[model samples]
Target: MLDAGIYEQLSRLVIAMKQKSSQNMAGNRRSVQKGTSAEFSDFREYMPGDDLRRLDWNVYARSERMYIREYFEEKEAVVSVILDTSASMHYGKKSKAELAQDLCAVIAFLTLHHMDRLVLYDSSQMGTPLVVSGGKNALPKVLGWLQARTFSGTETDSFSAVRQMQRRGAGVTVIVSDFLTEAATDPTQDCLEKTMQYLDFTKQRPVLLQTLCAEELRVTMDGTRNLIDMESKEKLRVTMRADVIARYEQELQKLSVRLKKSASAAGGTYILCDSEKERRALILEDLRPLFV
Candidate 1:
């Protein structure tokens, strides 16, 4: 369960972020269509049939340049929040699955509050898509959907999931997952290339990757224990020596670094979240900048 105070804080942070920058969606966000909004952007040379009122008289008088002021188009964006419900997400210190749900709920609430459409997708259920049109009544349904969901699925095939979402059309795609899927049969580069081809075909809108976990980032486990794959139920038992632990940590860091690089190469924003941190602050301080 999410704390009321945290929810309130998340609301405030989003509000504050919106206030700070009018250009919140300028470069990173794609518009659905052009519309009238009196936010002056740039001056362009007047074209035939241009509005007379938009002509810059001052520039016309000083430099004799027939320039017209252009304003940015204010278009509403559709935000789709995709949460990975795979078994691996259920094993984090603070439960990555729960955190993903909470984050998705908060984002959906904020997007609707700002008059943007919200869509929720669970990869486990490929056919049914949960959509909420931006309005006052949407929040209840969004929250309920998050609460009712149970994370008990097997492995997550992120590339396949991305392809599925793309077929539904373009929008801001926010994917939340640990991204530690089984190695593809093909080379990593080859797999990514194929995925990118599909993503291109569907024209996926701006993508943001959020990886959630606590223990995955830093290992503090000691002594002999059984380490099991949450999805596969495959277990490995071994004595944990200090040297072995150090080597494991190094490998984990390498994997994380590779994942981050892959996301960047795919023209997406990547954010790693420690599940135990204050969710609001983490969202505000680390993730909000990518959107803004």
Candidate 2:
């Protein structure tokens, strides 16, 4: 269950942030772009200063008056929250899966409070789209859908999921995941580079890559144990030698650097969150900076 006090605080935080920033919660600034609105977009001459793009060809064909179409301000921006509920997300001291859900709930509530449309999806066992709406009252349904979802042993296809979701229209696509997919030949570089292709697709705008974890930035595994792949159900027993642990830490840092670089290159925001922290500070101090 979500904490009511934290939810209320984050809602107010989003409102204040929107008010303070030049950026509006809606997709774009007020424009004369033709859309399904009552406001007149603009008038164009019978000729080409008019966008043949927005030309009322019907009016031109009938009255011989070549008036281009005009549009009104788009009211609501669609904000889609893609939450990763794969079994891998359940492996952490604070439980990454729960943190991902909480983050999703916070974002959904904030977007609805701002009158933006919200679409929620979980890509665990399979890609399951939960709900899409502009109603703040739908919070219960959203929360319930997430609450009822169990972490199953399923592989996450980030590339495929993002590709499919790209058709949902662009606004803000916030992906919350641990991002620990199977490594490739190049391991750190290959996984990130391939994943970034989907994020850079033309359809979506301002992708926010938020990685959640229960472990600290620097992970220190206690002792020798069996490491298992939650999705594949494969296990390996190994001892944590000092030098081996050092190398592991080095690789982890390299992975973080690669992820940050890739996200920046795609013109998106990346946030790393440890689920054990205070929720208020997590939003205000850590996650809020991404919006700015």
Candidate 3:
């Protein structure tokens, strides 16, 4: 879904991790382990048998004590991009599914550009999700897989896809969805919190990307209309008015607040994506914080 120019722009960036990875695979990002690297980590008192090369000779000459310099070991991080393929994603004038796919592709490109592992998950996938690792050479497979994705799930639960994933190692997860689960419609439900807890239990730091269409954000319809639930296919007939539209907007605001709070509580961040915005701006500007 990305053009060559977009890929070129993304090549200079790499996905930044909030926590040091514990994976043993060699990579370009810093890890929890200490090893020989250009990036200095800290200094520790030199012990017998310690490599003399790492010893701070100047310190030894001044303070009469030896200390060894340490560097953070670089290791690859696994990034899981979960796309919600629920029918609601197909509702927007500009399909949220398409936006979600593009976002996932951008993340994949960044992860692979930095030589990190990437695992893509979608709700419509029957069993295991597609996993790919390599440099730019693997981008074709990622793009093809994303191209085949279709939003057809009938479940209203956005996290159902995530819940079904096999437990993965410690890493960062990017979940792209409209997040219009039962919790959004019913304030009493705790779907968002529960999903965050699950991700935490899986040893994952989640990045919730909530995509919405312009029509959903601002209602323009007036008087008698039939509302249909994209997922459940439930129908309701009601007279639309100014107060009704205002109430809907209020509920939407509350949903965004709840999602942001839950993501933060789970050691992650929440991003509200407006599908109508330029894709380049979203990836290059709004998502810049994700890259380093």
Candidate 4:
């Protein structure tokens, strides 16, 4: 999904996490727990049995108070990329499912390049996800899995699939979906809220990647036509007048605003991307915030 130049730029970047990871394995990213790394953290007063090697002798000479120098520990992080394959994603000019696949590839490359763990999930099934770790050598496996996949699920709930997966070390959780699914009781926004809450509760840093097609954002065709629901296959006939399209756009904007607000309030990042954009632009510009 990415070109050679994009890969070169990505090599210099690591997956950025606002909160430190709790994984104990040796890695490049700093961990929430303190250990012996070159990076320095804040200091505290030295205890009676503290290590003399960590004592700041210079501070002791000036203030006459012994203090211990601490450093942040580096640890590996797990990045879970969940793809929503619902049929609704199959709509649009470029198709949301295709965009989601491209994003998953980029995320996989970044995670592996940085020596972190990677997990791949999809809405098509509820089972074990393809887990890979090591260096960039493992990238082909991820790509192969993505290539063999297709999006045609009618009633699959990707969030439920995520909840069913065995939990791993707390790190980054990137969800790529259209966020269009609605339950009988829970609305679209409410379902997203509950999913974010669960991710937060599991110590995972949430990163929501919302994909939408150009057609969904704007409707230019005005006439009496029939539209079918991709998921339900329910058909409806209506006159697509200017006013009708205008009202639909307004409501869509309100929903977008609410989704953005909900993601921010949950201590996560939300990015809405159009499927028609070039893969290069999406990686270098739109997705830059995801990297450090």
Top model number, TM-score: 3
lDDT of each: 0.63, 0.62, 0.79, 0.77
Kindly indicate the candidate among 3 and 4 with the higher lDDT: 3
Candidate 3 stretches greater than 4 Å from native:
36-73
Residue pairs with clashing backbones, model 4: none
**Best first by lDDT, ranked:** 3, 4, 1, 2
When 2 and 3 are scored with lDDT, the better candidate is 3
Please write out the lDDT profile of model 1 over residues 1-292, one tens digit for every residue: 5566655555543321211111113322334424457766767676433458878999999998898776666534556667888888888768888778877876776676666556788879856768666454688888888888888899977667766662333445667777677542233445544554454344443344555566776667779989898888999997889898888677666656665555556554556777888876776676674454
**Model 2, span 1-292: residue lDDT tens:** 5668876666554421211111112333232243455666455454322236667888888888776554554445556667776787887778888878878887888777666667777775334565445456878888888888787758675545665662333356677877666541146346556656555564343344445554535556767889888888899997878887788768667666766777677666667777787777876687775453
Better of 1 and 3 by TM-score: 3
In candidate 1, where is summed lDDT lowest over 10 consecutive residues? 15-24
TM-score of 3: 0.82
Mind giving the per-residue lDDT tens digits that candidate 3 earns over 227-292? 998778899998898888898899899889988898889888888898888899888998876766
| Residue 62 alpha-carbon offset, candidate 1, angstroms | 58
For candidate 2, report its TM-score: 0.75
- Please provide TM-scores, in order, for all candidate models, with all chains considered together: 0.72, 0.75, 0.82, 0.81
Q: Tell me the spans in candidate 4 whose CA falls farther than 4 Å from its real position.
A: 36-73, 183-189
Cα RMSD to native, each candidate?
A: 10.9, 7.5, 10.1, 10.1
Instruction: List the candidate 2 regions with Cα displacement exceeding 4 Å.
Output: 15-71, 125-128, 183-191, 194-198, 201-203, 206-218
Best by lDDT: 3
Tell me how many residue pairs clash in candidate 4: 0
